[model samples]
Target: MILLVVGADRVDAGKTTFSTGLLERTGAVGYKPRAGNDFWFDHDDCRRALADGRLYGKDAARLSAAASRGRAPERLNPVHRLWQPSPDGGSGLLGRSDREFVVDRIGRDPEDALFVRNATAEVPDAVADALPLADAVSIETVAEFNDLTEREYVPAFDRLADEIEDTDVAVVESYSDIARPLSSLDPAQVAAVAAVEPGRVRIYSGDRYCRACEIASSSPRDGAIEKRVPDVLDYLDPLERVRLPPLDKEQRDDPARIARAYANAYDAFLDAAGRV
Candidate 1:
């Protein structure tokens, strides 16, 4: 199984959307891999989190038959950190935390839990323990840096490298928007990361992508789509089924745009299924 780690220049480059897109492409559910109870969910949590509940009702139904594929979402996304929306917002363990929640407790296969993480250098130790070691791995690169400072991110990678220890090769998602002088990131260091895993693929959004997203925040023109998505859209062609940035926040709020993007992502899913 391949562990795909998605990233972007910063927050809105559509990591979640891209992860959703990849799941669609992979016939895998678009799960956060880190749904938690003071911890991320286990495979059973994903399965039990069926159509009966909120957003995942349909998903729970779809995944019901599958055995944790091989790992739990928590195992996939061992550690995470999210800032409270407002400074006063509560912040603690981001997702499900332990094997108990993932094992028979949540009620699914622990092995099949492959996770999708919006990783940074600063993930927690326990969370790192839970993540699956990739036979193959893919990392999405950022085009720009959001608020993360060189101070925080520089040491993060040291921690990240500690996780896998060593592997064959790790695919690096390349980017053009990141400015230099990032103490934490050294583009030159990509080769070293790749040294761990030599089999790699670099997915570019397009020969052309928006250098500047017109929407300050991704919002949709459609009423039902998500405000987090972009208005300009098109379905991904099968051969070009790689995930890209998601629609802006505004797009997530728009119903029509949300449907369109979801449909577009689904198209990629259909195409990918045909191959494997």
Candidate 2:
């Protein structure tokens, strides 16, 4: 088994897109290690999948369908953290403390509405059991752009790494850059990279010639992105590169084709890895 981590140069750079595409093409077991607390509530798709017996985070649902359907979303995304309103900001059952609010509430446990520490033990065995059964396994961390050093984040990352350590390909989303520097990443990012060590990192970015990409390419990380592109006959670095299509606005923003293009990019990745 090989672990193939799909990460973006920056957020929205298509990490999940590439992961889902690769899962489809490779028949890899998919695990979305870190998902938000309100994931199911926020995504109607996840609510639908869960209603049908498979519970998934937004990203996990897409991956489960594309790579291995029929498995429950809870199995795909076992470690989830809710981002509920802080207790001090609270009043209702979910927040409001009124009887009508209680009745109006979904009637689940009160603790369910709180953002608890990320506990790895929460990860069900079903995920571990399913991994070796596929061609490969792909794990997506929570959004990888924001608070990386938060104490709440590392346990889940450690847990995921331990879970998939033996697999042939381990594809992680955003942990690689955490160890860099504060100035390198966004502080208010909604996602965080897990701290799992990566064997190979493939930096995914859009076409440099694209207008939006050109602007994004102006950031500090963009300079890092530029340096990552090896010049002709340049010394081989450990990092491999995969460029996403220089899509028109429609194609670039289309969620469905995002997966398709990522699938296409994975083919290119395989060629680069010589896995082809």
Candidate 3:
């Protein structure tokens, strides 16, 4: 069964924190299909991962650690993108004014494939040198990037889904506010869906939630057209709403502590999912 955890806020909705606790309580495996970090803001994390000849955001790392049988961060998160801010009022290949794409790490292998954007020449020398450029696919435009994702990332996600089938429950976390991370995932496969904010979580029926996503997207189910949380929520009523207490830094990091503190909320989620 799949328990999807999605963010209501665009950023910092505590999806990872909530998912960690759920995994601890249920002994479920974790999966973060896609994730990213900014080069300017998440410098330390970027540098550390680069030092190990890889790239992965902290969320994926934490999810891997919280799982019943811990997996490699790359295997847990199949697609990770690196971004940098454009301070000089310039745009990258994707045409975003504030930030530009640097590179993308796709698939799960000892030597994962890298998609280095042509705009990387504009990045700082130290950061560029540290990137895994050897045997990397060079991308020049948004269309090319989209093509690459269709060709490569889709298959990687498929493989990851196949791997998850062996586990009893898989906690699937969506990126940002995206309703569903994997387009291929059937609604019937999901046990429950949770939309989380700062101090509360709203539970919805899995099939209804996926149908809402389809309505919100209003496009073909290619996983390319993503709908935000509010857009999907417009079509359905929640099964339950549970309040969450604030956690101290130590408590937030400890999965067992989080599970204990959030026992009520977890119970509500399981009950809504029909697991109880």
lDDT of each: 0.28, 0.36, 0.82
What candidate 3 gets wrong by more than 4 Å, as runs, is: 217-223
Better of 1 and 3 by TM-score: 3
Ranking by lDDT: 3, 2, 1
Tens-place lDDT per residue, model 2, 87-200, is 344342222222111000110122221122222122224332422213211122223212332333344445445554444443333222222212222222211121111122
Over 79-134, each residue of candidate 1 has an lDDT whose tens digit, in order, gives 22221122233221222122111111111233332233333223334443444423
In each prediction, how many residue pairs overlap at the backbone (N, C-alpha, C within less than 3 A)?
A: 76, 23, 0
**Cα lDDT, model 2, residue 21:** 53
By TM-score, the better pick of 2 and 3 is 3
* Ten residues in sequence with the least summed lDDT for candidate 1: 192-201
Candidate 1: where are CA atoms >4 Å away? Answer: 1-9, 20-70, 85-202, 205-276
- RMSD in angstroms, all models? 15.5, 14.3, 2.5
| Error of model 1, residue 59, in angstroms | 14
Strongest candidate by lDDT: 3
What TM-score would candidate 3 get against the native? 0.92
Best-first order by TM-score: 3, 2, 1
Residue-wise C-alpha lDDT for candidate 3, range 148-260, written one tens digit per residue: 77788888888887776656888999988888887777578788998999999999989888888888854322225668888899899999999988999999899999999
**How well does model 1 score by local distance difference test?**
0.28
Most TM-score-accurate candidate: 3
